[model samples]
Target chain A: MGNADSLLQAEGLSRDYEHYNAVQDYQLTLKRGEILGLLGPNGAGKSTTLRMLSGTLAPSRGAISIKGIDLLQQPRRAKQSLGYLPDQPPLYFDLTVEEYLGYCGRLRGIRKADVEPAIQRVIKTCSLEEVQKRLISHLSLGYQQRVGIAQAIIHEPDLVILDEPTKGLDPIQINAIRDLIRNLAEQHAVILSTHILSEVEAVCNRVQIINQGQIVHESQLGIQEPDKVFFQLHLARPPETAQIEALQGVESVIAQDKGRYLISVENAQAGLQIVTSAIIQNNWGLLGLCPQHESLEQTFMQKVFQEDRP
Target chain B: MIGLITRFEYRRLFLSPLAWTLIAGLQFILALLFLVFLENFITELQPRLALIDDAPGATDTVITPMLIWAGILWLAVIPLLTMRSFSEERLYQRQALLMSSPISISEIVMGKYLGLLLFLATALSPTLLTAVSLSTGTQLDWGKLIAGFMGLYLMLASFSAAGLFLSTLSRQPAMAAALSYGLLALLFVFYITGKTQGSESVLFIYLSHFGHFLNLSSGLVYSSDILYFLLFSTGFIILTIQRLDSDRRNG
Candidate 1:
């Protein structure tokens, strides 16, 4: 996964359904060894964006490439390198688990001889060994989703796109699928679109949030760089005292209580050094100095709400 | 690959017990009607039959095969067989998996068409025994029997393509089925209207399904009739592929 990068890229892709702009100028890029999550509320054009990237739907404007193959111009070649799991799993309910996956493998252009081994690998990966022969319609939604995922990757496609893979699953099933997505990222570039922010937090390496047909926010895992700094200080009462106020990078300090203060600082680490060192040297009790960073969930909500229209 | 797809489709659609039952049921009903009509012909015209003993009637040559139990069954049951081809897929939303796969649209359409072709051939098989029985026992016109089957197969296959085209347009199987029947009924009316008026009705000629059916069923194979059904099948299939493309783009 680390050896190769940027398996799928969609640049300025847009779609218009009749008079409505379902997705407009949606630029999304997916790199190998990364699980990019497409996050948006319902009717925010998530499905449209996914369909266009997968070439299951064409964009009215812009182009997409799978491994540098032009999707709109050479769809068959581009689609050969891709796999898409639609919101509806597209399971042929009448076919058994193995039969459906085998058919999908063949459809995805896997050689006839390699199909059996491919099916076996997907079955094991998706934990469908027990239900391999069972009819898909009889399976629970969780198993059905697993089957859906199994079919999507049976051909060992370089880029796998899943739309709401865990929508109807229970928590246990959701956890299992999250683990499955993480496992898939070990080999393939996985792009999943969901409204579940926690899903992005759990499995994805990066996330691109689409709101009303455009990208509103993009973030990485681990919240490495927060857009805003939050400060939590524990100290002995230090007012606008020289030890605190005379810090070189001090912006402002609001003393919450005798022992606690909410300090606004220009640089978080700089603020931490001065405030903690000053409290210690001045013989004021140095309890704690914590700079709060935004969680992905908070960042997601703020970006979405900030751009939200009345 | 096409052969494998055709075989898989054959099993999926043609091997069903319900499919066999539909074919056998239609076969028996048509053969029974033929038996009744033949018995009446044998009973009422016994004396006249002696006069034309060495001469075959034009009605036997033209109308018997043209309007036979086999011919009507071929045309009538086609809608049921083909209405679910694409409509069922659309309703189930399984078409994404089918169309999104690396297979070309031509292969998919042709594979399913061949599968339906096999099913239609199966439906026409039981009546072949009836043909053999009459040919051996009553000295029936073997040429006409063969021609009728060939014509009916080609004619009905063209109609089935139209049914499949309508199926691709709508998700509701019932609506697809009704719309197919509605178009078939209109074609029949055009032929009837042409018969009502003495001269050729150009609109009726253009629309008449029987016009194509008659040209071949009478043991006379005209290239025009062959071209008409061939063009009809190819045109509808192309339309079906385009509709699928439109759907994927909009979806």
Candidate 2:
């Protein structure tokens, strides 16, 4: 069931080839104004999941509702509310950028009278004004990719599904595309798949890390609150590990070479006060104290490698 | 939706030089054939026409053979024209644009098919015009000419449909073209084999598209021939739609 703001709802989604399952029981609920990033390794079914959600690939078993319209039962209506950009930009190299966008507008059921305005709107949005008259094949990879995005958003659909929108771009181009994607998400619910962790961190509001055809972890970006805090403690004279672990609120203390200790604590403020006061009371010098933040890369690696272990 | 796709496909075809080159080459060859047929009709057949009552006129002596040559030429040309209909899209992974759109599979297939037909018609226009130009100098058998044109068009439609279906079966455009050429040639073989066995080999003759096409080209308008082309084209078009639908499912 989808709520009013829910733009996409997929449940029990799975796809399989004859010999192996590609995606298994994938589920997602995307709300308006949210950028949901699908992060996975190569061959991890990120594209397959995006394809199924976009109505381009039928799931062997699943249900998908785009804007509350059943994709399987009423695909025409459901697909009208969403636009998709596959891994490769579905561009016809023979057509000029403007002509291709017009064709895409018409294909998306935009009225003949409104097609020009729609083309202008996406061309402007995608920053394709200068090359609008040039053939797509003549443009660089970045512009061709922008044209791909232009087609996807031409009809101003409520949802946009893109598979690896920033796959083969340079850093500057990737940033530009990310900005364009951010602009799109302001009015459309965006779901993009990528193997780049920083891409998810930079542009997505939430992320799902998939591995071996299953979602291993899902979390809201920038809001993950770990139960324990970690700190790298450097000291002129470090206390024994048992003495530090005996302190209240200090979870674990592992000694390192040259008087450094990796410390985990139950609470940041209280645990820091307790540990520092104990060190001062014991005459152990505190050379430096720094908090270590856990990055998404760590989580990704942990989830993916953890799943691969027998 | 179908109209939009058809227009796009048709324009896309013209944007490429392949279609233009094919059209020009076909016209040039047909023009040479037309001149040869006309020269024979004038220098060899015209003098004898007065002695034979109701002998075949320029329509049979010139236009019929010219149209027959055009038909055979198109048997090769149609595959080249229709080979990229679906195969190139799949090869480039551009079918996602249509597959993800709100349009149905049948609409996509029909739109591409009709677009190829539109191109075929354009390619055949000069030949048709040359045939029609004969009316200015001689009394043309309009009935036979019309029947021949209709038969050629029907045969081409069948060829294009089969070509389009084969295009869906493979991502390689060349492979699709070769497969379509082979399939059409097999039907021609059926006609040849059936002819050697005489009309008594009703099954092969009936199954051969060339036999039915020949009937129409000879100014015979049998419903059976019309039904055959219709069934052949429709069957292939439906198979194309089903193939695309299965691709979505199986992908």
Candidate 3:
């Protein structure tokens, strides 16, 4: 009841299964029109938290509220506000895409008058027009994913929680899902939990990294640079061993086999000019100079290992 | 809201070849068993009545409306109809979708149990038609026969609910079916053994499923039997709801 304004809120949520803590001391908030990316490795409790928020699960010790409706008490009301896409899509293989969406819409409490339009909107929005009449079992993995998203939005819920929505998708399918999610954010809040860090950057506005049942770090997209960069120097000839060490703020330079050196630097600007100029002045033919910002993968590793240290 | 959801569930179940085969096959097998029982009952009745001399005026009240075979056939079919009610959903991950929906636990549990019960009753219609056809052969105690049918309905309803409660406890369909079979076997064997020894030997016989089947089998309309079966069905349904709720909360 205290969290009526937020689209979804888990305050001090925790769940234990057979005496083992699945998710401990977890807190997340999804406001309207926002997409929150929950990132974590396998067994890190990403799915557990998503289950709790979706009302498929209830926390052992916490409050999950949707627009101020307490899920533990008024579950039906809270559930009406949530649309969840689990890692495995809960689709009936025998039903066609259109029939599946129609069933889902009704289950979510959509009025009879709106069932048709709701299904149509999601079909078009998810680009499921081609396979709308095909049986779910016959569709490819990518199209199945689209059907999952379509069902999640059929009732136009306030919060759409997609867990591994792009899992097992090809590059083209991944692009389609990314676009679909971006479009979904316009009408409802979205939270997509994934181990693929790049997915968060592409579609989500904010991200939280969880490890071993707890959130370790959270950052908003485009808020700040990733704080470190790598300069991959392609040289016609290997530079002097001390040359990389002499540069300001250069952490280390390791030979990456066959005349390439992975030069780690404190930031992008400091290493960019220094490495390029150093190559030219030293008469080392510079085949290429590439900058590597902290990709989501690296940040994931950084957080995971940092938390592991005693 | 629950009806609409359950109707959709029925449509889905109808499309599954596994579901169709079971429902259709049960009907086919029951028809065969009914014919065999009718022939055997008539044959045995003739010999037993011969000892009464030439008095054809004797009332065949007990032997005409033979429903023991019909009742036995129903016991075998109802549990199969309901054994996968919740187990298959969990196996395929569809239960998660249902649990997360804007429906109460009671609605979901009752909807599934009724859905299976409806399918089972549809299969029983032919058997009822056969009973009507047999009425031409002799005078039937129609009032008692109807009472027996009512008892069969409630008895199957109770068995189906017990199966459904077991289904919700496990994700494996075979395990769920085995569990219901195990419980049924205990009631059939132990109840008979105890009744033969002494009624007081096993007071638990009062709760045995077959004990409830007896009132209907013998064409005796006892309000206590009706109330017992109704309570049995309702009690297990409540158990199923709580089990699902626990699964949801524990996750």
User: Mind giving the per-residue lDDT tens digits that candidate 3 earns over A1-310?
Assistant: 4554577878899888886898899987778878899999899999998988888887888888888888888888888988888888888889999999998898899988999999998898888999999999999988888888788888888889999999878999899889878887887899999987778988888999999888888878865665677778778887775876787778888888777888888777866777777778888888877876556777888899877999
- Candidate 2 per-residue lDDT, tens place, B182-250, comes to 998899887888888444577888988888888888899999999999999999999998999999999
Per-prediction TM-score: 0.88, 0.92, 0.84
**TM-score of candidate 3 to 2 decimals:** 0.84
Q: Which stretches of candidate 1 lie over 4 Å from their true place?
A: A1-4, A223-254, A262-291, B15-17, B37-50, B57-67, B138-140, B198-202
Instruction: Give the distance in Å from residue A73's predicted Cα in candidate 3 to where it truly belongs.
Output: 2.4
Number of clashing residue pairs, candidate 3: 2
The residue pairs that clash in candidate 1, if any, are A230-A292
Q: Taking the tens digit of each residue's C-alpha lDDT, what string does model 3 give over B30-105? A: 6676656666656765577668775332122332233555566667655566667888888877877887789888
Error of 2 at B160 (Å): 0.4
Residue A275 in model 3: lDDT: 70
User: Against the true two-chain complex, what DockQ does each candidate achieve?
Assistant: 0.51, 0.74, 0.55
**Candidate 2 regions off by >4 Å?**
A224-291, B197-200
| Models, CA RMSD each | 3.9, 3.0, 5.2
Ranked candidates (TM-score, high to low): 2, 1, 3
Backbone clashes under 3 angstroms, per model: 1, 0, 2
DockQ of candidate 3 against the true complex: 0.55
Listed per prediction, chain B TM-scores read 0.89, 0.97, 0.84
Model 2 per-residue lDDT tens digits across residues A1-310 = 7778889999999999999999999999999889999999999999999989988899999899998899999989998998999999998888899998999898988999999999998888887889999999899998998898888889999999988888667898789889988988898899999998889999999999999899999988865566799999998987678988899999998899999999999998899999999889998898989988777899999999976889
